[model samples]
Target: MDRIQEIVDFWFLPESDENYGKQREVWFKKNPDFDAEVRGKFLEDFEKAEAGELLHWSESARGSLALILLFDQFTRNMFRDSPRAFAADGKAREIARHMLSCGFYDELNTVEKQFAALPFEHSEDMDDQKLSVKLFEELGSGEALDYAQRHLEIIERFGRFPHRNEQLGRESTKEEEAFLKTPNSSF
Candidate 1:
């Protein structure tokens, strides 16, 4: 119990631009003593969010934190704490729809805001999908679609983002190292 509380406190500390992102990555990815139960709780809440279980984040700071965790994991390809029994069933679309309509996301940290687009990115709705294609077409003879496709393909190849290597203190592979050198490495 004490250990769990300590972890929670560590996570909830007031975030600042001063190495906050690096500190967070180290704590989350490097801490060997991290409590699994706390992580499990985070994952369970993420599952709840994906299942389209509505949460009133404005009414509860804890709930808002869980929302942040869900978005955080999505960016890293950790969609759920545990693997789902079935594939996504448009529940993410529903959750994304709700999040877009809510004001709660305005409260997230800066780096977290970078992943704020995950829900929209994974939205499988036909209309949304059509819009993405339409937008690409509207860019007419431009490189928008090509660039977007290449980036998406890279993500498909690497479950997690390769651009985050330096940020996360991870060693870059030769391919990633080469990719990182290109202007198209990251946006």
Candidate 2:
């Protein structure tokens, strides 16, 4: 029910009036396979953000934002994929950066509760850790794997991964998997 989750939900839910699918068809052509609880939480967040309730962006947002921008740039240079999906808007990025600098994530959890109280159109896409890992890999820093593992462990520990994905899958490039299997490769 966080603000970011809300934004993510509003942008993807087929039934949502604010669905971003029409504007970004390729990003969301097929419906995501998320459960009702997850979808509800995301919608909860989206409603709060839309209501003008300020969210404290994560401390990791600057790093996250930078990586996404870099990945877009790298892909443009290397493979010429879709014209950069990262926001080029300096104002928005700056606002996000400032939020990251000013607030703690724990504080944001309270804000998320307020968001969850509101009703909103349902949405279903909550593979947040998977997306994080993908973003990390695209940045080519290998930190994505670390970030993914942290989230995956939480899901496993909480027994949520099975409900989320029968596979409870985590992305791994062939090279990365090989590296993990190799002995004494910790860096």
Candidate 3:
């Protein structure tokens, strides 16, 4: 398999397996320096995307940049030992691609069209249970839950991915924690 596929499969298998973390650990041990560099770059890109600079260029660019940001986040989480295996499932990729394709056609629609429009700010803060809920509603509960669970794993692995800065999230570990506690939680 190609390096990308190998990496993708390694990072995203399924949450039910105990071997996922072990396999990821072994891979990280085999490539420590490269992993660190990748993690750093991922963090940098993540921070940039979180700041919303990457999303302001164009609709398609914003969506594509979001995918890259998410991809890096998952890969970085893998190196850190969290190994969210469920991400490899095709549903998440399909939804992301669909979102990007929709973004490509966004210009064809009028400002008042109100189709699948994304928020103006493309920061990590913009990604939350609400977004997950919307995606889930658009897709299905299964894929949405899978994505949420994987996202939670990513945040837990980093000790701080996103949704941590909310005043309500200050004392919580899981993004879902604060989210669930909120009256606005759709899950």
Candidate 4:
């Protein structure tokens, strides 16, 4: 299978209750093996994609989605807890904006649409955060909408994600520190 196809297939599993949980586990929970596999197998491709070598991938909806995943999702796992984890965020957001403008985003199913909008959701910029909330609301996933609202609230309050402070080496303000202590503050 094509490398991009492999990533798309693995990350976007068939939708179901069990698969949704599995996807959350894989994406949210830290697993050494999964991280290592992503590092070993797709790191090169990721690097290439980052260098603008994979612009051709944007020619199709699935290809564009896969490119977004490489920049937004895989980078998080491959370089967890480091600034590098967010290095590709701008690129991912750019591709997402392109997808939306070009109408490719409309082709995706609910789960894929959520991911395609994630770069916006993960952004600290209030505008992007608001767009993320709008996208999630349109997608009609209560869970995604909740998370999007939470992320937007954080950005609205702090202008950034306090949870990323340690990784990015930024000092947290007192209010942000307090917020970070509360349950489910980071996401």
Q: Is candidate 3 or candidate 4 better by TM-score?
A: 4
Residue 63 shift from truth in candidate 2, angstroms: 17
| Candidate 2 accuracy as lDDT | 0.32
Per residue, candidate 3 scores C-alpha lDDT tens digits across 100-179 of: 46665333222111112222111133244345445445443464346555554444444443343342234545655755
How would you encode candidate 4's per-residue C-alpha lDDT over 1-187 as one tens digit per residue? 7876777877866344356423456777888899998898789989999988999999889889999999999998899989999989999999999999999999987778989999999999999999999999998889879999999999998999999999999999999899989999987
Clashes by residue pair, model 2: 6-46
Q: What digit string (tens of lDDT, one per residue) describes model 2 on residues 1-187?
A: 5444444343334334554333343321222342233344343433342343533332454333322222222222222222221122222334333433555212333222112111110011135344434434443444434635555444434423222221224454455455456553321
* Displacement of the residue 117 alpha carbon in candidate 4, Å: 0.5
Clashes of each: 0, 1, 3, 0
Assess the local accuracy of residue 85 in candidate 4 as a C-alpha lDDT between 0 and 100: 96
> Between the candidate structures 2 and 3, which one is better when assessed by TM-score?
3
| Candidate 1 lDDT over residue span 71-95, tens digit each | 4433233322222311342443444
Model 3 TM-score on a 0 to 1 scale? 0.30
User: Estimated TM-score per prediction?
Assistant: 0.39, 0.22, 0.30, 0.93
Model 2 poorest ten-residue lDDT run: 116-125
Residue 31 CA error for candidate 2 (Å)? 8.5
